[model samples]
Target: MDSLILNILTPVAIFLFIALFTLFAVYAERKIAGFVQDRLGPMETGKYGLLQTFADILKLLQKEFISPSASDKILFALAPILIFVAVFVGYSVIPWGPNLIPSNTHTGLFFIMAVVSIDAIGILMAGWGSNNKYSLLGSIRAIAQMISYELPVGLSLIAAVMITQTLNLNEIAFNQGLLSSKEIYFLGFWKVNEIGGIFGWNIFQAPHLMVSYAIFFIASLAECNRAPFDIPEAESELIGGFHTEYGGIRFAFLFLAEYAMMFLVAMLGVVIFLGAWNSPLPNIGPAKLADWTTGPVWGVFWTLIKSLFIVAVQIWIRWTLPRFRADQLMTLCWKILIPLAFVCMAISGLWRILIMI
Candidate 1:
């Protein structure tokens, strides 16, 4: 009975959290855009537009659902829901903190990489079902970009897995914490026990993993279809891309899914490179206060902070950089990031072997 309730309630709670965060992210994006352009955003809503997102939600809710006469009604309606569902499934395996994961599968990382990529299918569905040339072109572009970038993304993750020798995200995070607990030096020529803290993060773990992280971060930007690489939804090009034909609640679902994907990638990056829920501050090793801060509930707190920081970087990039030309986008993936990821993965493997020896 307890397990059953936990199983049901956890997912519900996660969805609620995602919804709330998505609202805040929208507001933040607008406010940041305003800041970048030296304008006030949402000043007319509620308290500098605090209530703006909610108002927008209400307005979207009241808008009538409209589909074009030529559209495939069934597939068009299903696409948004599928997109959102794929993100939710991908979010399930994340280790927000100790014992906090909903599904602690052995193949947690693999599951995430696999399921998240399936969202491209939803985009394809939205495009084809809309029966619009623009939408179809946008969807095709999105799929191509996503599929191209998935190579580096997967390779970077596999590099991390090679070091950890496990597919479980929780185990990866746990390994980071363990790695954090001590300072090893000169191939164990000298060891300082329970001294190192923030230095233990995978981002700082080794040179090759750092290279892997760089590849992963860039690949993730493309995966989330954010700026610079947002060729599919480039307003100048595809208007609204695959969701061009969607509006009202369906558009809202697509919007929600995009932000959710942002959060998902950010959280996954934290788990893989930033030490999951581990505090950046060093504590007297193995102390109760450390556990309190790094443990399950507080783990969620740290994870949120780290994830939001990554989201902020993404937003900053969105505002700062121009969209990549389609050819440049493909060239970047195929010519640069893919080869770099392969080299990093090979080096990461070699580094792991040397460390183990």
Candidate 2:
């Protein structure tokens, strides 16, 4: 219960969760990929290839490390580690479960965006450091795509904060619960707490906010550099995107950053738009599962279940959707998602004013 102990243990727990999740995610991807492509996946490794990810890790670990002759040595080496650190740091700000957050700072949303924005720099550094034209191109694509999408993503996040009137992620989660008592905090100490929470978390707030949440998720996909927005690391063409030259443990770290970022964004989405650690029903919101009735274990259990459902959807999209072409990617972001996000912001403003008046 000491803040210092919490500061230390929480990260260990988060990364451990991420480590286990990554192995499972890899297997899940294989299984989902099989189902999508009409074939069996990971049937031999563990039951239905459940242990497939661990096996992949072993293989990846054993692979040789090869740096390109002309690569930017220092930056290339530092880039992935920097990325992993940035993303992992963001996880500390995520509100995991009720009465069960890491560092519930008022600057949570700010911290989330700040760290995520930095990841673009890492992607670019890795791409350029590889000293390969295709990798450079991939990283460039990643930079452009991620930067473009972040604007709308920021706008949508602004919408949530503006409506909720607090930046503390735990407070936001508390507000979203569909309960009568309305237990919401505005700061580390209660600040001007508003009412009604967010209109059905954040997704259902306004039709436009719903649109913004969609835009945010799509932008997040691009930002995370996942499928449909995966041009930066188009495997068939670029051989591995920014990480083409990386191998062995270095490559592992790159993806460790990738998976960590994936979890960070998913959890951020859950917290920002979906009400971080709050339960769906209001009655359960105030009473944490750690309360006398359910026990702390169930509280932790349900939290992971919710978070994983979001992550699973991300995986589902990856296997189902083909990667986007670079030109199409830019067009979707600059032309489509950005403008759409702006409209959502404007509408959200209008709706809020209308409700007040």
TM-score of each: 0.94, 0.87
lDDT computed for candidate 1: 0.85
Instruction: Residues 97-156, candidate 2: write the lDDT tens digits.
Output: 665777779888888889878888888888878888888988887888878888988988
Worst 10 residues of 2 by lDDT: 186-195
Pairs in steric clash, model 1: none
Provide backbone clash counts, one per model: 0, 2
Off by over 4 Å in 1: 178-193, 284-292
CA error at residue 110 for candidate 1, angstroms? 0.5
Candidate 2 wrongly placed segments (more than 4 Å): 178-200, 282-299
Q: Write the per-residue lDDT of candidate 1 for residues 91-129, one digit (tens) a residue.
A: 889988876789999999989999998899999999999
Best by lDDT: 1
